[model samples]
Target: MKTLLSAIILLSSVSAFANCPEFKVPKKFMARESLFSSRATDMTFDAGGNRIAKIEERLLSATTTFDLYDNKRQKIATARQRMFSGGTEIEIKDCAGKIIGKIKERVFHNMFDIYSKYSILDATGKVIAESEKKEILAPSFSVTGTNGKQLMKMRLSTFSTRSLDEWVVEILNDTQADPRILLMIPAFKTSADNRETEK
Candidate 1:
C-alpha cells in the first residue's frame, strides 16, 4: 500500500509541473524523494527535472542532521535538530558552519492555534518568519515572512501526507527571503514531529 501511494505521489509531482517548455524553473521548483525512498535522502529538481540540490539526513549525537548539496556534490548547507532538551530548536547553517536560520517550536503559542505554530529565525537569532499548516478547503502549508507575505507553500501530491521525509515544495516567486533557509523548514519540522512522537 505504501509503495502504491509513493508511486502515486511520484506521478502527481511529475505531472504537476510538466509540459511547459517555456517555463524555466530555477528558484521555483520541487524537492522530492525517490520512489520507494527511505528517510535517508531527498533530491531537489527544477521543473525540467534537472537536479538542483540533494539533502541527506543522518542521526548524530542524538541530533538529526540534514546536509544539503549542490548538483556538483558540493556541500552547501546543514540543518541540525537537537533532540535533547525536548528538541526545542533546529539550527540551519551554511557550508561555513555559520548559523543561517532556525526553526523554533512554540509551546504556548499552540494554545491559540489549532495547528502547530513555529517561528522562523534568521542568523541573528531573531524571529523573522512564521509557518502554519492549513487543512480547511485546500490542505496546504505556508511559511510567512515578517512582512506577512507567504515565503513558500508546500502541498502534498495527495490530500494525505504519507511521510514528512518527502514533499512537493514551491517557493513563492516573489519572496525575497533566502531559498536555502526556506528549504530547510520541512526537514526541521519533520524532526520536530519525530521528537514529539518519541516523547
Candidate 2:
C-alpha cells in the first residue's frame, strides 16, 4: 500500500503542469524551446525511449536513425535523413528537437527564428561536441572518433539559390567546441500580437 501511494503521489506531481507532456517525454529530462508562442518548437534528450513519427505544419520533415555503441566505441546504428522545404523554407530539426547547424543560402532567411545547433556536455558544462546541418553531395560530415570527445568538420561546395527547390540538411557532430550548444527554451515572441499582452 505504501509503495502504491508513493507512486500515485509521484505521478500527481508530474501531471500538474500548465501544458500536457509531449512526445511521451519526461518533464525533467526533456528540454523545451520555442521560436513562437503557444508552440514548443524543439525538445532534446540525452537518452532514447519512445519511437515517434509526427507531421508538423511547417515544411520541416524528418528521418530518424540511431547509433548504437557497445563497450568499445563502434558505429552500430546510424540515423540518416533526407529533408526538404515546402513552398517557402521553414525549420529543419533533428529527432532530439535541435535545429540543423548549417543553413543553406535559400533557407538562411527562415533560420532567424530557429537555433542552428548546440553542444552535448558533461556536468561541468564543458562541451562534448556540437551539431549543425549540412548537405551530403555539397558537404558530408560525421563524428569520427571515440566517445566523450569527438571532432566535427563542415565543408561547403558552393552557394546558390538558382532553382529554389533545393534542400538537404544534416546534423553536424558537435561534441568538441566552444559556446556550448544552446538548448532553446520556449518563450514569447516580440510580435505585434504578443506586444499587447506584455503590456
Candidate 3:
C-alpha cells in the first residue's frame, strides 16, 4: 500500500511539471537590455509536448506577442506580430486555405516614420479574418467623409471561436460588411475608422 501511494504521488508531480513551461533564457538574448528585444522567456507545453503558448516582452516598442499553436503542430493563433521584424506572418484561411484574413504592421516615413498596427475582423466580429495598414488601400471602401464633413468614427470589437478549437478576437463596425474593412490603428497612432466565406 505504501509503494502504491508513493507511485501515485510521483506521477502527479511529473504531470504538474510537464504542463508548466520549460522556460529558459538564451545566453545571447539575455545580454540585451531592451525588454521588447527579449524573446519568449516562457513556453508552456501539453502532455504530448505540443507547444501551447509563448510569452515574449518587446523592448523597442511597448507591446507583447503571444504565439499559440494547435495540437497538430500548426500555428493557430498569435497575439501580436508587427514588431517582430520580418517574423513569420500567419494567415487565417478557410478549408480551401483561401486568405480569409491576415495580421501585419509596417513602418513608413512621411518626413518621419509612421508605425501602424491593425487586425481585420469578419462581419460577425468573431474571427480576425484579415489585417492591413491605414496607408494601404484595400479592395473595399474608400475613406471619404462628405465634402465638407470629416466623418470620424470608431468601432466595437468582438471575439470568435474557430473550428480548430482556437480563439480569434476582432474589432468591427455596425454595418454588415466584412469587418476586415475597418483599420484599427495602434494606440500610438491616430484612430482610423473601419471577410469571408468558408469552404
Tell me the tens digit of each residue's lDDT in model 1 across 1-199.
9999999998987675343222123645665654223334444544557777766778676667888777777677788876434326778877767777887765433434445466788888888888876535544578888888887788655523444435577767465345666777655555445545556
Best-to-worst ranking by lDDT: 1, 3, 2
The parts of candidate 2 lying over 4 Å away from their true place are 1-11, 15-118, 122-124, 130-136, 139-141, 144-199
**TM per candidate:** 0.67, 0.22, 0.24
lDDT of 3 by residue, 21-63 (tens): 3222111110111123123222322222333323222223545
Clash pairs (backbone) in predicted model 1: none
Q: What TM-score number comes out for model 2?
A: 0.22
Q: How high is the CA lDDT of each candidate model?
A: 0.63, 0.28, 0.30
User: Model 1 segments beyond 4 Å from truth?
Assistant: 1-27, 34-45, 83-87, 107-114, 135-139, 159-166, 173-176, 190-199
TM-score winner among the candidates?
1
Q: Candidate 3: which stretches are off by over 4 Å?
A: 1-37, 41-88, 93-100, 117-199
Residues 62-96, candidate 2, lDDT per residue (tens digit)? 43222222213322222222335521111233333
**Candidate 1, overall lDDT?**
0.63
